[model samples]
Target: MTQLTTDAARAVPTLSDEQWRGLLEVRATDPGAVARAYAARRRPDPLLSRKESLFLVAADHPARGALTASGDAMAMADRRSLLARMIAALENPEVDGILGSPDVVEELLLLGALEGKVVIGSMNRGGLDGATWTMDDRFTGYDADSISESGLEGGKMLLRIDDRDPSTAGTIEACAQAVTDLAERGLMAMVEPLPYHREDDGRLTLLKDSRSLARAITIASALGTTSSHTWLKMPACDDPDTVYASTTLPCVVLGGVPGPDPAADLHSWGRALVQPTVRGLVIGRALLYPPDGDVRSAVAAAAAVMRAAHPGAPAA
Candidate 1:
């Protein structure tokens, strides 16, 4: 594993060769250490930062075979590079938490890098990126029970509703059950309800129009037996005011695939953050593997965006 470094010395902690070897040794001989590490991990009292907003670094894409970043087809395929980028992003104090799958979270726990962080386990990654059975997104990752048992603060699931596909119904049912289960445990269930349009080629395209997104948000807000523990993860749509008006649930904007221009993405995020119900940003690729390839700079710039937004929202 290459040592992860940043141009700014204070941005990311220096990782040494010994630490990498230690992680390997534990994986090879002491698999149970992951559980102990989870128990030992220190969690943030309030999931949101002092800005009263949640800025989570999303590291769960790889589990779903969604690894493209910018122009790179396999930008997140290298685990070491991915973990290094994530560690760099988390070093920024403005980042409130992380939403990751079990493998990635366990690795970070073992690295002693997840202390004082709000860890939300990612669930339902069975719908691989390019698979034909994508809409039937199954719970192949963390369940509500495992998330609670692992001492995580929350659990996140992707709910993609494709009107043309019958599998979407089953996914909605599963997500509803998950929401209820998490609520029973008093854990946050972050639901990312996305609307999709499928073409004859079987390719799924996301529908980010205000009407589509608003409907999706409303549907997601009504999931499970109760909405007490539900928080919606939505796209920073062109008409965020209209899209966000569909539900009163606390929302967080998600960073989609990295576009050609980072500034353009930032501008859209700015617009979305102004919505009264939108809380913060849950981004991954745009910051971790930016066009400039500077993780620290990307993270700092994103933090500046959050601080510049309405920083007086309710925390936790």
Candidate 2:
């Protein structure tokens, strides 16, 4: 087996027949390559620079059966394309790390793209999008022990609370346990709490109002035995000030389904970034599959917004 290097210049290449074949060869012959790569990975130390913020690229949506981006329903259905886009986005120096499920994280580890990057493990992915039981999110992906053993920096769990659904209680309980477990291991516990209401047709619809989101934030912040190492991942809402006032825990904005206008989305994120508690961004589809299909440009534009929002601040 060929050993992978950590040189950023030669880390990841365009998805091609040769690249695919190589990855398959390793998986077929030496299934332990994934573990080997992870064990030998050059991890990023000190996670963040002095007072610098986080900028993680999220790719855990597909694991939850949510792949639409900018109106393209199956835009991320192709694994090769998705990995290629992730590589392109991570190639930029501004990107501090990645947040993904076990499979995606291991693949990037084998590709040597995660070297010197803050790797965040996605914990709950059993709640498939558009499913009848979407509120019963389970810890089906990486757990705190696995995250620690794999040299990951943090664990992220999705908490969707539906007022009308009883399954939401199970999700809340599981998220609280995950937070406690990760915190006990001295790893960052990132919680994404979103409020939802069931419609007459039985579909769950997210409530973006400041009050609802603010309530969700308070609930998530109080989870676990302690909030010492917990972080919040939230949407860049219209009333960021009011919504963010719920907690002092560090917060990162998630770029939900991109709107028709990309500039408007960036503007909204810029406004949210100015909030003292809003640390940075953990965007996915919007940056990975932009309307113009330029992954590099989209990522650069987002980094520019973060830089502008914190002028004179050192890069994380």
Candidate 3:
């Protein structure tokens, strides 16, 4: 047996041969943790064991004023209701993890639901949605040490670059420093990069040009002291082929706002998720505050899409 399979076999000694095969099948779909999986198989580390083909529902809406579900505005404004719904979702067997602002995360922490869970802290909320400073992202979430102390799994940040805007420069520099800081502490930093361009009329648009997207990827991938723990949170570019070739870093496609047909959005996501470097997804409004009212159903549907893309992949 290969080192990975051997390690996996030893880790779950209680499993029969059939169960071990099933576990190996699950690990095949997760490109992001393949190495870790291999190591786990050889000498299963408690920290590295993961489920398969899962996604983290983003509940960072309150920070961005996107507090609605299925077009119902401010649906997430009620802290108790939101927390109840989130806890309910987390309790679901299908749902794997959570992505939210520091405040929301702390709430989860207080509820004691974060233990053994994949808790990803949102690192930017200063660029509130539709605000004038939306593009100038800020690090408002848990820092490296804070994440470690909290017993959280990882951290995430937004890096929207509108070259014409001076604030983007600050965000870039701060992001680089954040990456270095997170890496030094042996934590994962998921960096979402967007090459945004503000028109003379102040309308913000993504620069879909291959060169610009590639450049943005290069800059993002090269940030921090060590790129080993860095993962790129990217949008599915107009030319996915070019975007796929832009960087060697592992990536996850981000889910934008909900569209008229949520299933179609997931279908598109399924395609993006299949890319070799695209490890998984960091879906938000599309899954949590879906146009549909059922959070459980919506989350299941999203998980189904992820599974379809890479059946039996290790869960996030």
Candidate 1 TM-score over all chains jointly: 0.93
Q: Can you write out model 2's per-residue Cα lDDT over 38-147, one digit (the tens) per residue?
A: 89988887777444888999999999999887576887787888888898999999898899999899888877789898899999999998888888898899999999
Q: Candidates ranked by lDDT, best first? A: 2, 1, 3
**lDDT of every predicted structure (CA atoms):** 0.87, 0.88, 0.69
- For each candidate in turn, the TM-score is 0.93, 0.94, 0.78
* CA error at residue 293 for candidate 1, angstroms: 1.2
Residue pairs with colliding backbones in model 3 are 7-41, 7-42, 8-41, 26-312, 51-315, 52-315, 70-291
lDDT of 1 at 251: 93
lDDT tens digits by residue: candidate 1, 1-316? 2223454434433356787788889999998999899888888887767666889999999999998876767878978778888888888877887899999999889988899998999999999988878788999999999999999999999999999999999999999999999999999999999999999988889999998998898899999999998999988878887999888889999998877888988888888888889888999989988765678888888777776787554332
Candidate 1, residue 47: CA error in Å? Answer: 2.3
The candidate, 1 or 3, that scores higher on TM-score is 1
Per-residue accuracy of model 3 over 1-316 as CA lDDT, tens digit each: 1122453323321323554354445446543343332222221123222643335667886886666655667667866656656765676655556888876765555454555557777777788777887877777766777766655667888888887899998998888888888888777788888898899988899775778777888989988878988988877655667776877888878887677798788777877787777767777767655543455677778777777777765554
Error of 1 at 281 (Å): 0.6
Error of 3 at 173 (Å): 0.5
Query: Could you tell me the lDDT of residue 48 within candidate 1?
Result: 62
